[model samples]
Target: MKVYGLTGGIGSGKSTASRMFRELGAEVLDADVIAREVVEPGTPGLAAVAERFPGVLGPDGRLDRTRLGARIFGDPAERAALNGLLHPRIRERFLEQAQALADAGVTRLLYDVPLLIESGLHETMAGVVLVWVPRDVQRERLMHRDGLDAAAAEARLAAQLPLDAKRAHAHWVVDNSGGLESTRAQVRDVWNQLRARD
Candidate 1:
């Protein structure tokens, strides 16, 4: 089985690429989904988070994601603490899901991890597929997508490694600066390449 890592900066359309890959018959293990699953109301992940940051739970006893996000965004120490707690569990879940998929005879698999590069998983992948966009486009999309002002969007972008830096490390680059169909075409080309390599 060929396991590829799909990643991109926020608003660079990694999610769209993931969906296109799914349509192309690849089994995708999305880290964000697994992260949320691991931290559900009764899980140890949530318990730890609640303990670390009190008042992050809602009246229904579930993690208030917005509140927690507000508390950690741009706060390096707090953000690191949260990652220290969640990353290990998320990695474990990814391994479990990948094994199940492999057992079920899945060969072409993609791990859609937003922080693939930051988390140092790129070296572990068969190949890393980076969805690329210009910094201006990324900033525009972030503001439009998340309703953030320029300064706020810039801060979010500053949190991750620059797109140019990540591009240098990618095994495959899918340029997503154009229209949706253009991005889809790039995905199709990469899909063909991946299948051929396997």
Candidate 2:
């Protein structure tokens, strides 16, 4: 089975590409979904989180992600601290799930991981799929979608590897600057080429 790590910067249309991959009949794993799952309600991840950051949990005992995001986003040290605490747990879950899917005979798996470049996880993949858009478009999307001020949105973008760099690193690049239909057509063409392989 080939492990294709699908990655892109924030607002690069990774989410949309992931859905298109699923629609094209590829088994897809989302790192963000797995990250959230590993820390749900009564899990060990939740307990660890509580121990690390007191009162960050909601009254209902769930992690207040919005609060956490606010606390971490602009602060480099805080962001590093959070990543240090979460990356190990998240990586473990990813490995376990990937292996299980391999065991179950999934041949062409797509792991949608936004941190692929920064995390140095590109080496783990058989190939990489990077979704990309123009920098201006990405900034505009993030502002409207996440309601971030220009500076904050720019900071968020700066936190990740540049989209053009990601595209250069990718085995396949899906340019999403055009309309959704154009992007989907490109994705479909790529899927056909991928499916033709072993």
Candidate 3:
């Protein structure tokens, strides 16, 4: 199986592109989904998080994402601490899933991670496909999608490496700033290219 890294900034339509890729028959391992699973109720991941950040779990014994987000936002140390606690568990789950998929004879696998480039995981993939959008479009889409004001949106965008900078690391760039059909067309093209490479 050939594994590719799919990444984009928040609101750059990365999830949309991931769905399209999945629809096209590529196995996708989403880091965000694995991250949530690792911390589910009764898991050691959840227990560690609850111990480190008291009061962040809900009455249902689930992680209160909003509370945790608020706690980590604007606090680099807290964010790093959270990453330290969750990343290893998430990676373990991701590798397990990949092995299962490979055992099932899956060919093209896309590791859909928002931080593939930032975390330096792109080096492990066959190639990286970045969903790209101009900075202004990214900021506007983020504000609209997340119901954030311009300032808040910009602050969130500023937290990550800029989309333009990430383009340098990509083997394929799917521009998703235009209409749905246009995005789909680009995704199809990328998919074909991936298959050809395999």
Highest lDDT among the candidates is held by which one? 3
lDDT of 1 at 137: 97
Worst 10 residues of 1 by lDDT: 189-198
Better of 1 and 3 by lDDT: 3
lDDT of 3 by residue, 101-123 (tens): 99998877999999999999999
Predict model 1's lDDT versus the native. 0.93
Q: How accurate is candidate 3 locally (lDDT)?
A: 0.94
Model 3, residue pairs in steric clash: none
lDDT values, one for every candidate = 0.93, 0.88, 0.94
Model 3 earns a TM-score of 0.98
Clashing pairs in 1: none
Highest-TM-score candidate: 3
* Tens-digit per-residue lDDT, 85-140, candidate 2: 78898989978988999899888888899989888889989889889999999999
- Deviating ranges (above 4 Å) for candidate 2: none
Error of 1 at 124 (Å): 0.7
How close is every model to the real structure, measured as TM-score? 0.97, 0.94, 0.98
lDDT of 2 at 72: 83
lDDT of 2: 0.88
TM-score of 1: 0.97
Query: Candidate 1 on 1-198: residue-level lDDT in tens?
Result: 778999999999999999999898878999999999988989999999999999999999888999999999989999999999999999998899899999999887899999899889999999999999999999999999999999999999999998889987798899999999999999999999988985
**Better candidate by lDDT, 2 or 3:** 3
